[model samples]
Target: MKIIDVICSKGRTGFFFDDQRAIKQGAVSDGAAYIGKTATAGFSAVRQAGEAISVMLLLEDGQLAYGDCAAVQYSGAGGRDPLFLADDFIPVIEQYIKPQLIGTEVANFRALAHQIESIEVDGKRLHTAIRYGVTQAALDAVAKASKRLMCEVIADEYGTEVSDREIPIFTQSGDNRYENSDKMIMKGAQVLPHALINNVKTKLGENGEKLAEYVAWLRDRILKLRLSQDYTPVLHIDVYGTIGAAFGNDNYTAMADYLESLAELAKPFRLRIEGPMDVEDREKQMLALKELTRIIDERGIGVELVADEWCNTLEDIKYFADNKAGHMVQIKTPDLGGVNNIAEAVLYCKQKGIGAYQGGTCNETDRSAQVCVQIAMATQPDQILAKPGMGVDEGYMIVYNEMQRILAIRRAKANQ
Candidate 1:
């Protein structure tokens, strides 16, 4: 089967109360949001006005799948929104990509992917982005054509068993200042009066100070819930960094301190840490990350590092890999120039024994998320990150959930 059509959808989606809580208190922003709900909380304040740019691909033999790319301000790049590229870039997908793959065999995903990657934009090239877009579309089409859930496809492809254990997702709440004392009291009284009183603390501001307290609360709550045999839900926290030169020495110190605190609080729950690094401040960010890594190692917790800015190219991955800079490498297909590049990076990481995670794009939709899931499963990265689907527009959660199901099936098949 060949690709029969490619569709690109552009628009914005507003956040929900819970989404806002995650973005503000959880520090959700950029690609980090999709990996899990806790990670998306980092952008609580900024994600409000953001838009989603989605690309969907349809193929012959009746298959439909898609993905999305979202843009947010880069802290180091003078707070400029890197996702701004989507505004001008989506048209390229419509003009160059849609018309070319009308009759290609649906299973020739690689060829369709390659052709999409071949398209160029300005003096720069967008073949990678186009390939990613097309691949996702094909996956969606195939899923639809097969009359199977995405999870089933993933199981067939990966040959692994799906774990019945509920995957953990982080959710954020509380005011920015951590001063929702009254709210906390009301909520806490129902649960634990003594513990609430003991944990009662003053409100901290939006920066790391407030995040520290909020994180502590989340960790404690998770542990308490687990003790009572309420072990299904996973715990998470969101930590946002200031953008541009604003992320200077002070910011790094605050981040370091907050992460250290989180390590201490999260030890009992074995919580995982995933967040977007400020790519604009390369030197300072690296220095801060190095410190954070030490903390994570000491705590024996897994850390997923996402580079919204720094890891935007193949060369960037080389730099990180060569230096052994990060533990788990986060990759965004569009940012890396396409599926081939992302695949190459994953291969490099796998060969190097470096864990890889798939980063999400806000501009993506179900189609884009589907494509990402396909590539993500194919790459077998350690983790898959995508946006939450709670707000006005459905986020990439449906795609992610679908992909998770697919991966589960693949895992089952593999074990068989």
Candidate 2:
């Protein structure tokens, strides 16, 4: 029942690495380069796989389990980094956290995780990536000790029921180009397209007209594809809120106006706009967005504003839900401390009646994506994001196939 070993390893996400935005921008000139903090003069290396830290635990009984550590390239505002979460991961685990729990009972790992999260390497809270990894390894140990699925362990931890039905998968468009979206639709997939207006604004100034044209094209293509399919996928766009920057005034009103236009562009398709404004401070963010919601509601704007950015932890998720700040909150998987905290956030959002989109960075690894699908299906969130990479087909296949296996296991147990 005691954790005997903690193993942390570094690998690539099999996707080109980018700092903040989903492969939308921040890509090197080639769109496949992996550049670190210091860009080399005239030559950026093409990393075969983006950097990722995967944590696995070996128990006394020889069972092993893993957790996904999706450390985003950019951790702060405007994609600030000379830093990556992978840098601190090994030191934090081997030097700081490993010694504390090598002999601790797996049953007490939840409290162990709480202690690990509170530890500061010199005046900094443990990175969310480290929290996710350590806690996931710990939870996996507990599940193995009890001979139960990690999702079942999570439900029992939170005193909630795991929904028995299959969870739906949502895929992201491979790139910002509207035509690329049709490929996934042709393959019978639901897609998430990042408008990446923030990137367009940074590189090509005040390009709202261009972005809107792309959206119009996407709407048309999706409608044409839907004529043949039974499932009408939602048109979910994550604008890093650069649309707000497109206006001369650069305020809430300008953002709201642009959003209304986008809403009109997405006629009759269920539309949700994630991150319309990218402010880092939570209180100010909620206050400002609450005002935007008021404006949208009063004017009857069709788009829904989703909160991301600073809404990282379980507390942040709960706060947004309690205040009714955004119509929905993007429950970024890495933000919640690990599986247990993630389950709590999802169930809390469900209880509070706020729409929770179980989402994460595209920089994640495949194992983490599979781990996420299990928890999402177990908890039954409103939607789940495709992960590990931005390639719509690859990410969708990994998540979708994992969900099918989970369904089969659940059905077999029911018959038994």
Candidate 3:
């Protein structure tokens, strides 16, 4: 199939973008909006609606394959790309990217995606959102051209087998940790409640008592509400570095002691703590996490450490994985620039004996979430995030349904 033309359209993401620095610096929440000046460079407000650009490729056969370009909720804070406003970037994509893609013969995905990753204007690579979406469109176009599922295309190109079973889905509960978790339990999410513990005062507590209490509560609630006793979901919480904040950031021993306490509280359920500390610098963050992981291993702490902050790009993930920075690394899909990198990152983590959690942000679109499911199906990460929103049902539905569709189609093909 050949690309006839490229189309860009403004779109809204499933969630809003929040200034991570402002929130960490005590931005008070006023309803859904934050009541403080923006601390991030490109933000007009501490919290604002997330924007996306849908890059659609018009193929010769009248097929429209597209993907949404988006950024994380905490854009520009953790060494990520700047806030992705569609108004500013759509024109850039049209001017620089559209013409190059026009009339290009699409036979394979990896080369086309890498070409997108290599394009630059004014001496800088295209915004991560643009590269992310355009590559997704490329993958979809190749799949459509070859008459196969997106996951099949990925698996074929990457020398991996498509997952015969559904990847475990991890659902996030924004602030409605209690209520939304109930929803997750009812739905039987494999990984229950990302429990966004971002702040020290409100969520994590000054001494980490608040999060401990919440973990205990979650244990009890899951036991009570689960329809099937076999539905023992892993408790994965993204603390956003609150554990490090409560205790000193470099105080690995203290952090490990606290992690042990939480592990004890989460008895029968396995626990994973993500972003225990974000030193804000990649090298420092890796060392801190490595030391913490070493301590946890030496002490035989039942808790697992997941790396998130400062591990943005494919190279960053490899750097962290090479050092064993954390037991698991979150391949933040959008942060990796191209979807091709997401697959490579996952495979690399597995090669390095590191757990790969295929994750993106709540500030994404349904289309992105769907495409991510295809990637996870092909790559078979340890767990794939239920994304595009924090509300349990919508994100979970988008991810779960896509996985089922892929599995069903693959099953039929095998029978045939």
Candidate 4:
């Protein structure tokens, strides 16, 4: 279909409780560099820091065709306090993107994406964000034209079929240092069919005192569900030093023993641990990781080492492969660049005979999620991390349901 018009919407959304600090930190990073020094200085300084969401729409034959929402932090240069609100991005979408996309064919997704990327902000490329908008627009169009649910379109396009049996969606959770993990797990539970809850570090608050008790509770809950039969139910744990630090220096040995105990208890439930190594202490982290891996290996338990902050780019992936850092590589799209970049990383991991998990993101919507799923399927990864809507006000439930539908359709076609 030919693109006729583009419509872009900009608004504010609520932030996830745990993500506030991270979002503020990101805003500060941008604010330090861009606020007062650039043309957007005045605009950026007055803006309030909150959840930013953008919606763009593509039309078949109109001046107002494409639309999508961009939700992220905006900063004022010089480390200013007043951050840019979501609304600050609307004018840019209207002034720069609207005119360019008008009268273009909807099917020329790549060309349109490139055109959007060509638009620059503050002498740096905004291609990543622009491509995100284009993908949203294309998915919106496909959903409308096919007269199918967003999930159905995704399934049809990717050749994956979704089954009614619950699918286990894993996410991490904890407090203080592990707060982000907690929010991610709770959000994942809300969005996916079945949640493989990751009880992260237990060295914080009175909560730490009840770590063992809570794990037992969680274990019992899973057993009651009997999720292992129909769904891939696996509990994951992240063994970063932060957890050890919370409990004090002497707690490191104790924590390792606790993990061994937890693993033994989790054996019957088929629980897997995903240890994301902290790169800060390279030597120590590697040694601890090896010990953990060996323990799991001896017990014939599955363990995946997710390189989060440790592996951000292609070179990082290579390093992990070279050193045999972990059993599984976690692929985060934005950090790796575009879809193509992530695909290459997956290929590299596959060649090394390592499993891959399409990592979660805070900035993905329906469109971005589908693209992630497509990449995951194409790579044939063992597990795909499901982020869904996460903190987005759009609600992850809707986004995930749509994804399941699309995955179902894609699997059906692939088999046929």
Please, what is the whole-model Cα lDDT of each candidate in the order they appear?
0.46, 0.68, 0.94, 0.46
* Residue pairs with clashing backbones, model 2: 171-192
Cα displacement (Å) at residue 13, model 4: 4.8
Q: Ranking by TM-score, best first?
A: 3, 2, 1, 4
TM-score of 1: 0.62
CA lDDT, candidate 4, residue 141: 59
Alpha-carbon RMSD of each model = 8.8, 3.8, 0.7, 8.2
User: Candidate 3: deviation at residue 115, Å?
Assistant: 1.2
Question: Candidate 1: minimum summed lDDT over ten consecutive residues — where?
Answer: 191-200
Cα lDDT of model 4 by residue, 302-392, tens digit? 4344554445555666666556666766665544433445556776887887766666444344545555654454455555555443332
Q: Which residue segments of model 2 deviate by more than 4 Å?
A: 16-30, 34-49, 78-82, 85-88, 174-176, 201-207, 227-229, 248-253
Which of 2 and 3 is the better model by lDDT? 3
lDDT digits (tens) for residues 1-416 of candidate 2:
88778888876764644444333335444554534442322123323345667878777888886775665434443322223445556776788777776777878545756766777778877667777767777776777888877667766766666667656566775454455477667766654565444455443247577767777887788778765746566777766656554563237677778878878988766678777665646787777667777788778888887877678778988988888878888888876755567777888899998888888777777887777876786678888877767667678888888888877777789899
- What is candidate 3's lDDT per residue for 274-367, written digit by digit as tens? 9999888989999999999999999999999999999999999999999999999999999998999999999999999999999999999999
**TM-score for all models, in order of appearance:** 0.62, 0.87, 0.99, 0.61
lDDT per residue (tens digit) for residues 1-416 in model 1: 55657677765532322232233333433442322243222333333344555676565545456655443223113122233344666777777666776775544334445666666657655534444545555555555766655434444544433334322211223222233222223222111111110011222243445435655775565455443543423233323333112234335444545555655665554433433344435555555555555555666554333333455566666666655555656565556655556656766777777666555444344545555555555556655544333221133345446656765775676799
Off by over 4 Å in 3: none
Top model number, lDDT: 3
* Residue 265, model 1: Cα distance from true site in angstroms: 3.1
Evaluated at residue 21, the lDDT of candidate 4 is 24
